[model samples]
Target: MKQGLIILGVLILGLSSCRKDPEDPLHKTPSSYKPTLVDPATIFPVGKFGMPQLPSDNPFTEEGIYLGRMLFYDPILSFDSSISCGSCHKQEYAFAEPKKFSTGIFGLQTGRNSSSLYNLAYSRKFFWDARQSTLREQVFEPIQAHNEMAMTLPFLAKRLARTDRYIEYFDKAFGSNPNVFDMSKALEQFLMTLVSKDSRFNGFFPGKFSLLSDTEKRGALLFNGLVDFDMVTGLATGTDCFHCHGGALAQQNNPDMGGIANNGLDGNFTDKGYGAITGNPADRGLFKTPSLLNIAVTGPYMHDGRFATLDEVIDHYSDNVNYLSPTISPMMAAHGNKQLKLTPQQKADLKAFLLTMTDSAFLTNPAYSNPFKK
Candidate 1:
């Protein structure tokens, strides 16, 4: 009888040990936990353009987006945990840094201006030089760049593994034992959710012309090349801007539509732009044409961040264009040595038109804001 009682007690002890504790870090998922799968298309609808290109292997989920949002705002991804992806890409500035060049983790400045983060769902190429082919691949570049986050994938993975919250998030986001690929996918999912189609300019496309002021309306026409000013005849015609920055997204939709252009920023190919990536001389001085959305807030324009204001940008196109570059776009060449010669009123109108592209809702949306801050 004594032996049987001892055996029963031992059995009970073993069973209790096998039972997972509610607070155990490794077994954090509760019995009620269920994966919440979310369709990326539902959150980011296809507007005038077709569906956003998403990787089939890494479809979005509520859990994944949550994890990605945390990672994006967390300084843990940086070498010293002092800077985050959000450091440069602030939500209020349309996910663009206000500075001409964003300072990195170690106070090192980036080579190019930080581009805005909206409407990336329509983009096939990433970055000013169009070097990265996909969004997921692009996420890793800034994290590993010496002047940026400067953290290795292996180190990041190990550091994340030590945190119980991160481990739980990883498990919920990418099943057990999440790796760097999982982290990148989560970041990509969050970024894909940043859609900016509700701008005032969007109203004009839907026949709501009243949304724009008179000055802005004229500017819109000039920007889309609906009205141009002939240099020699002093007559108004198309500005010829739609050739590079057109479509519903107000940026090049594909490579065939001149995704990158020399833009006549410089007479000499000092930075070499896309030519440096492809090692082709003809591609020199060629840089990707960024979207005009939120141009009012995303100041210090151009690849090198030379123009500090929209007025300066307009002045460059109006009176000063570098035609000496070998790879200057044919559309720009059509203008020849003659400038657009926009009048003062015309320039102001154009600036007003660009301001209408600002999506007030996107700039203040809590979802895109830093999660760490109260």
Candidate 2:
């Protein structure tokens, strides 16, 4: 009986020894975490662009990203090597040009304002007019634009090949291939990594910021569609601001839908927004609805950068453009065929809510800084 009891006790001990402990791996040293480390659950917060679906050809890698970073801040991509992608797309202003318009080669200002670079990972098409289909294709546009960089691909390749520093970088980034000399691909890789997901909105919400205040929360609720969007007036009752700019990124159209608008720019006379690209009249003034992630940062709002302040912009929308021609979007028909008449307090609250979307971490990330500097 004693021998049987001892064997039973030994069996129980063996079973306990074989069991795995949940925290055993905690003692092991971690090698390193990635620069782009992100929590999957919180990938897309309100007003934040979601993860990008990358093309198979231009797969993302740390080495490739590093190479691209060097190319982005390097002015060598330009005709005179005095300008670069970062020249107009300054980091401080959310990668937007400080001046109302951007000056390219020979001090010539481009027709449109330089758009801010954020939530780009979620973009399907690029540019104010949505001319380019892919970021890769878009990178070359400014380089070849007459008023912009004005440098051809062959010339850029020759220029890059001339420098020993570039030759070494090209070899390390791309495997023994001449294609690495094409700065566009490298720039695309770098730009793709320019993600800004660490904002007050991205991080802790109502809990983290006690200062967010009740008014701001109410303003947000209104901005989103707790209030109904008045189709007739284009003014949202109960603060239906989300109808035009609504989504995870507060964009009209996301990866799921497109937010191209014809918002009464002209009635019958038109800018022909998306239609210019497709040659379809229906697409007139149907410009890509930009993400409102950093709306406060990138202003002189709208495609033309006409309105300098949020107050002016609010006024434009609140007071419908009935005087403009007939090509206006149906949304403009909401507010009794007029614009919104938000009170002064409402406008302030809306602005406060918009400021919540700014992501400071992205604005000051050392990884995205000029690589030429130590």
Candidate 3:
């Protein structure tokens, strides 16, 4: 009876050794992990005009956005752990840096100003030059650029793989091991969720036109070109600004409206703008017409961050635009070297209208804030 009892005790011990413990991390199965699903449409609803289409290959999910948000704020992705993507694209300044040019991890400065990042999901082209066509492609440039994050995919992958937490996130996000492709996709998903459509300007559509003050209303009319003046009769009215910056997004909504233009920033074409990319002289001095949304916050305006104030920007179109540039946009050519000739009051009103575009909710939203902060 003693021998049988000892044998029974040994059998119990053997079973305990063979059985997988629920508490053990290594024994965890992928099947046990359920990814948090998310509907992109619910997150990003269709606007009055239309919403940007999500890529069919890379659908958004809650887990994926969380992983992307983590990666975005993490300096771990940088080669020297000095800067992350958030370093240049800050949330406060509408995801734009206060400095004219963004300084890199090694203290090198990028040539162009950092563009504001809100409403990028609606953008078909990216960068000041519009060199990158997709957000996924656009994200890699900064990561690998010498003046940017300066981290290679292989290095980043290896670094992330070493972290158990990152490994778990990658597995949940991609249903597999971490890779550069999935990492980029995760970032794209998070960026897509950065929809900024809750400004006072949006209220104008819902019969809340009274949201804008009297001066701002005048500015809005001028901005939309609703008030047209008789040129010969000297009866003045419109600013004709709707050509380039129109639609609820305050950007060109159609391809026929033209994507990039020479806004007459300079006569000599110092930077060559989009010309260098397509190797077309006609494209010289032409750059993407950035959205006017949050224009108040995103200054040091223009591609080169040359204009420090909206007044200066208003002044450029008002009186200083160079119309004779060979690559001048047709929209600018329509003015025929004649300046906007806005009065000081009109300029003040225009500036006031622009301020209405500022989406305060977007700037302070906790969802978009740095997740690393305790």
Candidate 4:
């Protein structure tokens, strides 16, 4: 009986050793498959945004990004085959819709406004509430959301298998058949490549005050200066907009460093923003602070999309802050929680400064455009 058991164990070991990974030619991946490698330097502006932490398991390839792009623009990813990721996230509006709530499959509306997609490689947390930590994992939520694409993994896998383009791309990009794991990696590669560096603000950053117009220069002062109100007229001497939305990226990267906070929007816990994710009372009303890079186009601001225009947004910070909010950020509570109370001219100057952050090149980049549209 011992001899028979030993023989069975050896047989099992032999079979297991012979099995190949999905990358192997024996596992349906063609031996001829050789995806074109993409240099990380070309995709990332390391000097500007710094070299982002990349996924070691998935390297960038031309075929992989191309496949991911197709997946992004393809309506077939949805349950009813009615919408694509690009539907809500239009490039013209900096990948954010102008609406308060994004329309999903079956005309269902999303609870939160669609976030602008750029410099995503710099963001540590995904979504307004900071629920997800990775782009690959984050992609699944929208696809599976009942109001969104509403796609089942099994159904999506089978659907991809049936498509000729997906089959060819899958083999060329990942050296495997259609699968969700590789699909996400490909999407990650494509998403990581989206870099927004060409903007008036980017060009004249650091201490190049000579490059900015007079109005913009004054606005820059208000933005970066500390919050100080004038003794007379009650106007703010400085608005101090840089605490959260600071640095060249115009946004804080670390959650502890103001990447996530309650901006004194409300005193009540109606939404419970980040608190819903952590189940912590202290975190209630706190939300992720987005980069101000494309703020000009990416409005209906805030997580719930309460403010419609940039004017409204400025008004909130200038006068409408709810300092009494239970989970308000300490930064906001600093200086006795005084409102900015910027004058109309100061508000216009600040708005002028914000408009400079818009990257027109990023909005019209053909590389990030729809593959099917062309």
Candidate 5:
């Protein structure tokens, strides 16, 4: 009987040895995915961009991301526990607020629109007003803001510390201790993994997904200037859409000629974007021009979320240069009297092209979803 039991145990051990480990494929590592050239028809390659500066103290970890996601969707961060980050930034709308600006937990509306969290790993600035520099710092803004979450960090930390659920999560994520409830670091790990590089626009990014529709191909020609000037502009004299919205990312912000343009906002408006942060006259009315990837879903456009639709945004630029702001971008002024006057058919084509920027894979990815589900 003892010999038979020993033989059975040996057989079980051997079977288990042959099975693949789930955690082996995805382990805790500091290294990023290597950039690979791919056929655009097959797989979308990750977009090339500057690596966002991460804090050395709070390194990225699966446990931390998992915890951050719970905190992000949980209303416990709010004073009334009625609102969360997901409250404003809905996944259906590409993680952007549906309204012009999101109403906070207290029913007071925020001054600026909620920017989409898509590909936020690449962004240097956080808010439309450019208040927070890092994503870590940005997470704290809504928590303390009277209009947003309206919960004090220290008080909230205390609230979380008392909880058995959080205590286990925090200890697992960041070593077991009394100081493990630091919310900022935990939140940053989660935000870092919110990468969105799977867009159709990413097809052209590093030569991936080569197959594109004829209209989309033509639209790409117009966007990247593969087509002739008259054909692209419909006989307009000046301005190319890709000039300002440049690079693989579609939003240019280089060191020499950084592309944060004022975009000819009518001086009648009050929102002074970057100027609010630096207090520089040159930086007035200049906001960070975001990536066009998933642009279709993230609407109510512009810094203030003034234009509700893409057509309105395109129409505003079509021969209606309100060069009233002192800090209006020179590129806007250079558009001259005439605009990129596209025919009805061409406009439709452009809209279709914009739609191609949508990356459903990233939008619906389970990795970035709220891990704490009922």
Candidate 6:
């Protein structure tokens, strides 16, 4: 009986030794718990765009950006787990899809064209209708849109908490359990980092005539010149594009000028655009004017994606200004209700200048690409 009791005690001791001890509070955080903050100056063109007005609450961090990128490419954010934000906004097309309308959850169509995502940090307004005021709020719209992601916040929170990677990343990025608020801040951090300033248009400046071809030079002249008629050809030498799309950023960020305008796509409003949002009739037909940084690729232009090609777009401005539209842009109506009537050569030149805005680097930058893809 004595030997048996000793043996039992030895067994218990061995078993207890093999079992794990209680975890230390200091070991709770991973040894790699370091949130490297990203400098806004490194990503933003401070000298050119005057340092994009970033959200003070959500400063850029490497971990947060990576987390947001994973979320962007992850379809799990959607109701059916089918499409992600990246699905509508592809990196190859400067984060703006080539399709006329974006296909959302259950293959439903979005109301407007997928706006290109870049240089957005510089602009205060968002969406083609300028509905949202900030990127964090903007992301929630598509995620919950019945026709888009069709996701509910409660479900999204649960799904995010369910994922092990999100759990780890959420802790690493925000030192919190997977939650929707941090998710939005992470997304905002990533979206604002998408800066597009490497295009040829950004490099070309005064006395840089050699940088452009003769045709492009003429196009540049026409693009930047005032809306004055040649008197002989009854065509404008200058298209006066500066009124709306002017600036080193190739976009007017000011709300009064190029931030919003009605390009006379229609005299009557079918969508009522910003008007619907503000409940103001005067704001009807107005849409956010996106930067021309990647104009060549971000085609199917306008709020409705009406103009399929640049030629069609030019033709509308040159020959089809709808002055009869009650709320027509004062800048557009300033043309004396007459068309610019650009010549064939002039149109080609204008197109050439516009093509210079395409930044191939921005299109293929792996940083913005889908992290899931090999």
Which structure among the candidates has the greatest lDDT? 4
Off by over 4 Å in 1: 1-33, 226-236
TM-score per candidate: 0.88, 0.78, 0.88, 0.93, 0.80, 0.90
Q: What is the TM-score (0 to 1) of candidate 5?
A: 0.80
Instruction: Show model 3 residue runs off by greater than 4 Å.
Output: 1-31, 206-208, 226-236, 253-256
Please write out the lDDT profile of model 6 over residues 176-241, one tens digit for every residue.
Answer: 778888899999988988888888888884347789998999999999998998779677889988
Clashing pairs in 6: none
Best-to-worst ranking by TM-score: 4, 6, 3, 1, 5, 2
Q: Is candidate 3 or candidate 4 better by lDDT?
A: 4
Which residue pairs in candidate 5 have backbone atoms (N, alpha carbon, C) closer than 3 angstroms, thus clashing? Answer: 39-209, 40-208, 40-209, 40-210, 41-209, 41-210
Location of the lowest summed lDDT over 10 successive residues in candidate 4: 22-31
Residue clash pairs of candidate 1: 225-239, 227-237, 228-237, 228-238
State in Å the error of residue 141, model 1.
Answer: 0.8
* Displacement of the residue 50 alpha carbon in candidate 6, Å: 2.2
lDDT of 1 at 32: 43
In candidate 1, what are the lDDT values of residues 138-164, reduced to their tens digit? 999999999999999989988888878
Higher-ranked by lDDT: 3 or 5: 3
TM-score of 6: 0.90
Off by over 4 Å in 2: 1-50, 177-182, 204-211, 226-236, 254-258, 267-271, 320-325, 334-336
| Candidate 4: regions farther than 4 A off | 1-26
Backbone clashes in candidate 6 total 0
Cα lDDT tens digits for candidate 4, 24-131: 322673649799999888898887778888878888999999998899888998999999989988888889999999989999999999998988888879999999
Scored by CA lDDT, what does every candidate get? 0.82, 0.67, 0.82, 0.89, 0.69, 0.87
TM-score quality measure for candidate 1: 0.88
